[model samples]
Target: MDDDLRERIETAAEKHALLNAVKHESDADVGAIMGPLMGENPDFRQHGGEIPGLIGPVVAEVNGLSNAEKRNRLEDLAPEELAEMEAEEEADDSLLPDLPNVEAYDEVRMRAAPNPNGPWHLGHARMPAVIGTYKEMYDGSFIVRFDDTDPETKRPDLTAYEAILDDIDYLGFEPDDVIRASDRVETYYDHARDLIEMGGAYTCSCSGEDFSNLKNNGKPCPHRDKDAETTLDEFEAMVAGEYSSGEMVLRVKTDIEHKNPALRDWVAFRMIDTPHPREEAESYRAWPMLDFQSGIDDHLTGVTHIIRGIDLQDSAKRQQFVYDYFGWDYPEVVHWGHVQVDAYDVKMSTSSIKELIDAGELDDWDDPRAPTIKSLRRRGIRGQAIVDAMVGLGTSTSNVDLSMSTIYANNRDLVDDETDRYFLVRDGESFAVEGGPDTAHPPLHPSFEDRGARDIPVGDAVRLESGDVPAEGDRVWLKGFGCVRRESDTLVHTGDDLDVVREGDVDVIHWVPTEGVQVRMRTMDGDVTGVAEPDFGDVSEDELIQFERVGFVRVDDRDDDETVVYFAHK
Candidate 1:
């Protein structure tokens, strides 16, 4: 809005037009052009908060110019000047913060430990991005460890483990190593044995209610004073099928008088006869609790930094006891509060979503309605957009509530420039165009004409969405073409001039040939069957594109006959 900013944008816009010309492109991409301009101008960087607001006006300004005027302006700048400006603007800053204790470690290491009980949601996706950022920042290693220990309650599905790994890989943050906790049951048992032998853990036979009462009263259970040798024997018997479920638990020794009763003699290992999907099966009867296992794994795997939700801060406290007992330093822990995405009404809990999925009430994890990372990926939400959204919120302790618009806006900025525009007519109605051209060549991208155009045949009639058709006698512009007047199921071409249509209050409509590729647009709301440009049929699966006047969509499944795309957003 500032005069200086306007001048800067004008200069950049001219250079953009010229560059597109050099590359033989059809148009300039406003979003693409603004990214560098914003990066180069400190003022733009300071004021350019969100992508939507930051580049919206500059795009409008550039788009307002005539093709002739744009070409004339492009001639103002020399090639060397444009190159220098591009070089100045192309330097991008790292989007995340510095690691807390980078100086203390020779090789920084982090891990995104996911309990593979169900498909990953957006919340779970945050781990890898934050961990991956630290890895990049410190030039370290990232481990994707599956903490699938609780087979009874939070049971691990073998399919989910692979799905999780696939999701992480899709995020562009490939783990240096992958670990399954179920396969390391013996390692946990070894740690349990060490704790028992060191008199840091005891076998408790107290009922759930009795243990709670003792914990609440800050009193140690009768089993707490038992000799380490005796407790070790009980632990061995428990693992050897001598103890029934809930009959005995291995509790790590902590101060009985600790203020938080939950932390006082918390259960380290418990008996669960339910078989693990990956390993041990029915052979292993005891499994370490999350905190116990995570604590041990963190140390054993050499994790130097751990970032997780604030709800698990107590887990850190309990894990510290184990670390203290072993005379080992706990990793630097950073706890952030919950982030509430307003778009999803459901719980977004993996266990809950899994139940619905198993019941056939929902589709797979990639169902658009679900908030899983799989859904986001399928819906054309970029991984970097997700990371940007998460990191923008930062590692804070306060709860943050936000709309999906923030993420959608980020995604829009990411895909807008690259996404080619196409015409789609939902529930189409045919209308013959009198005096219209035999073919229409609309730029694939409005700003970046160098990308070329989609050749759409005029045919006998063009298909327009039922809502897009103008009433008889009303004038409208069939975008990329010129103004036309409707006359009872027929469009009479007024002129091939855009200025006439722009000067008049004519409605702009997107249209496709009546005989084009059939498309089934799968949206979050519902399915919309439409006819798209024939070229859209060739769009590869997972390609992100814009259906002009409709919305952005990702090609989900495609064949020669029909194309299926997931509608991302308008």
Candidate 2:
């Protein structure tokens, strides 16, 4: 082995030494390794006292190893040692779910198949969050299946691909692979052809409304009696682009009298003349339905468990039917119920939002008012806060409303540790009270032990509330932080006007001096409340602090020097 390789093995050996040391500690203490702890991090190598006798086996298995072997080795150490080792492995960005104990069962395979017909809203965003969570919790593979089988309604937009990927990444998930349904039309066609030859599928020239009526009437179509050979011939012709769009559709040969009409004689494939953006004008023209694509792709990718929202439970049944047809092993599914919000029932869709966007009624999908991942990110919602809310929710198939208020209530607590503090004055132009030269104390911060940052210098500026100044005297309460004296009210607009610097007539707003570098924020606090002048320079993004008087805020977007931030507002 090379010198570097030799050095790596020695490092692994040393890691075991440290693990041994930590295991020998009086307390079964766990050491937190800040970075990669696999090899040289001896702290993780040791077995705790809880499983004292089993450490020998772990050491024997780990002791003489090649540099590469040590790096990739899975621990069969004592229970305590294995737990710590598993934790270290997990922290490396792989959520390996429980491995099956038996040797006969197949590896679990799962995927997330989302339709590209519309922009992915909040609930759609929840899919990746749940998938990533389970991927971490269960150790499974996740594939992003872009279900663009039906090209008719799926709009041609460049932003669609970038938007979906950005949202997933923003929520902290980088899928190992991404599969677009449009690209796999040929694969789906081949599978459909296989089913057709096996007498499991047939084509029907049924009209849309007529087919629904036929389904409701429980009548079998004449096409159902067609021979498999004729069906296969027509299917081939359809693949060769012989059929026009919507002229005919190929469906699985399921019974029309089945209780679930949706399952009864369901369309498995369709002909879409709409040009696919990425696939271009390839040899294939027909495509399989989403559930078909999901079933096939999940097995192909070797996904073990699927953690999807309960809204797709019906979809599971349809996809499961596909699995049953092929006699394929189905993956386990844990469905969390629909995460809803009042007036933002993503259970249906924001077609209205899309319509508004297209009609120019709404500016864009990222409109602050819109309930989408992009808009939420732009509006300063912490990705962590969203995940926190999800984890805390009791898993159920029941729907729940998650309003901006609900999020803010949780996020308010999420941001309560930072040292950032300031007041904002809205509507009023200038303060009647002045600080000509005198400076006053503002307690550094509300709670020194809890809020004040030793890194940031506290300001001692005499701030004033524009509306709090008494019309008669210089007396002013100065609000939450301290009191200020009214020197004079400068009315540049109207000399005698400006409400004559009235007291109690208008509410006074107090704010720190602009020298601290103000940060502007916009959030839904019952309504649209914008904080245009916040003392952001005094706060570090790492410091998750509460804005005593204001709601919870987490600084997400920031400039090199200092600039207004777009933070998660709760």
**Best-matching candidate per lDDT:** 1
lDDT of 1 at 558: 71
Relative to the true structure, how large is the alpha-carbon lDDT of every model?
A: 0.80, 0.56
Clashing pairs in 1: 25-449, 25-450, 26-449, 26-450, 27-447, 27-448, 27-449, 27-450, 28-447, 28-448
Cα displacement (Å) at residue 429, model 1: 2.9
Task: Please provide, for model 1 over 56-136, each residue's C-alpha lDDT reduced to its tens digit, 9 standing for 90 to 100.
Answer: 565565556666655555546654343333322221322565668778988889999888887788887677877877787
Model 1 spans with C-alpha error above 4 angstroms:
1-95, 559-561
Q: Pick the TM-score winner.
A: 1
lDDT of 1: 0.80
What is the C-alpha lDDT profile of model 2 across 1-570, one tens digit per residue?
345433443444445534543333321112322122433333333423322233333444544554334444423323334344433332343332343432333433446677765667776766676566766655556678777666557554545776787777887788878877677767887888788887788899988888888888888877887888999999988888898888888887776887888777788878878766564534456767767777777777776776666776766777776677788877777777777755443333656678768877556776556777776766556666565444444355677555444444444444444335555433223443233223323333655644433222213332333444446434344433233444454211111222322322233334544234445554433233223333445556534434435544555446755443444552
